[model samples]
Target: MGETGTEEAREFAHSIGPAFVKQYYTSLAGTSLSRHDAFYGNTSSFSCNGEPSILGAQKIKEQYVKLGFKEVLVDLEGGTFDFAPSHNGGVLVVVGGSMTFAGDKTCPFTQTFFLAPD
Candidate 1:
């Protein structure tokens, strides 16, 4: 809600980054979604039921559920960075959650996604 609160939350998230990474990988094993590992320009822009947006808000709800994460609360904190595409076919996404996963990771809600050309 407040900027200072978000900042503190982000710092706490950074402190626990490794744990979250481990948790994320462990969580990934139960779902169909694979982590994004490509570049940005070539990737299909993320869509929320058809609307285009960087912060998906609620796009991957089912995917996360399948992955076994509790639904994200509204005050979590996080950051996201776009990756450069490896070749010419896939899109790369890197999203991390803070203490609350509030910023771009889970508050608005989104995940790393790679869209490869068919």
Candidate 2:
């Protein structure tokens, strides 16, 4: 583990942030939700729209699966940033974008992901 923040860590975060965003949304839109298993696990947690936080990754994935979206167009809009360096080498990514669902219905959404090197 390292201190709270460092220039080297911030640089590392910036380097990986956009690539991770691209890969994440691309996979979400084009692949089965199961393909996203690598992004979560028993220890991972998630929540959307301030709903009660789901405690584990599997359950969180289940919620997304329930949405039954066959296709979603993700537009990387404003607010994408490598906001902070967290415990160890983790990168905190903050992103805002639009998700176009079926029938051309689009919604603006922002998401934060803390990517930790495990």
Candidate 3:
């Protein structure tokens, strides 16, 4: 690609991680627990904390509801995101930070996601 086109692509790639993270976090921070379901398609799969993988959007949403976080707090400023571009125009995101479920309850976490472009 040309110089300006390359720069624009770089900037766009940088913005993708934060925007995706914001949307994902927003889904977890509200009463609408099912909002995140939009992120998953019928072919999507999810696995939590070494648990067996769950397939399909409905099942994944059900598993999340079962977790019943009710509340989720992340070390926003302290969090870090690593991104890698995929061959199919997707981005692999690795997020690391401390998470708190309630007052004085916190644990370090690292989550990975493959964000496929629409």
Candidate 4:
């Protein structure tokens, strides 16, 4: 991406980051995965902690489903979104946050997303 394109991508990514995070946490509170799937593309990649990378949207959904969380409360005040333009005409977004689950257990997590226009 050129300088102007990169800046535009950055601004766009910044504008959507908060809404995306809100929708994502809302999806985690529900049973359906469709909303979550909409945030990722077919070629999207995901990784958490030191685990192996999960490639593709279907596999990513499967991985999330396997977590088996009935509900999640995101601590947005403690979260951060860092965005940049990628070489493939996509925005690379890195997010970090703390989440509380059913048993009052909490964990910090960081996730990377390669978001492209569809």
Q: Candidate 2: which pairs clash?
A: none
| Model 3 alpha-carbon miss at residue 116, Å | 1.3
Q: Model 4: residues >4 Å from true position, as ranges? A: 1-6
**Which pairs clash in the backbone of model 1?**
39-84, 39-85, 39-92, 76-100, 76-101, 76-102, 77-101, 77-102
Q: What are the RMSD figures for all models against the true structure? A: 15.6, 2.0, 3.4, 2.6
Candidate 1 lDDT by residue in tens digits, 3-116: 323555345434444444455545444333334212224333445445545433243544345333443333223455444332343333355443233233633444555434
> Which prediction has the highest TM-score against the true structure?
2
> In order, what lDDT does every prediction score?
0.40, 0.76, 0.74, 0.71
* Candidate 3 segments whose C-alpha is farther than 4 A from its true place: 1-11, 102-104
lDDT (C-alpha) at residue 72 in model 1: 33
Candidate 1 residue 83 C-alpha distance from true site, Å? 2.5
By lDDT, is 1 or 4 better? 4
Greater-TM-score candidate between 1 and 2: 2
Ranking by lDDT: 2, 3, 4, 1
Using all chains and alpha carbons, the TM-scores for the candidates as numbered come to: 0.28, 0.84, 0.80, 0.74
lDDT tens digits, residue span 1-118, model 2: 3565778877788788888887877778864676665678788888887787787777877877765444777887664555677777788889887888877998888889988887
Best by lDDT: 2
Quote model 2's TM-score.
Answer: 0.84
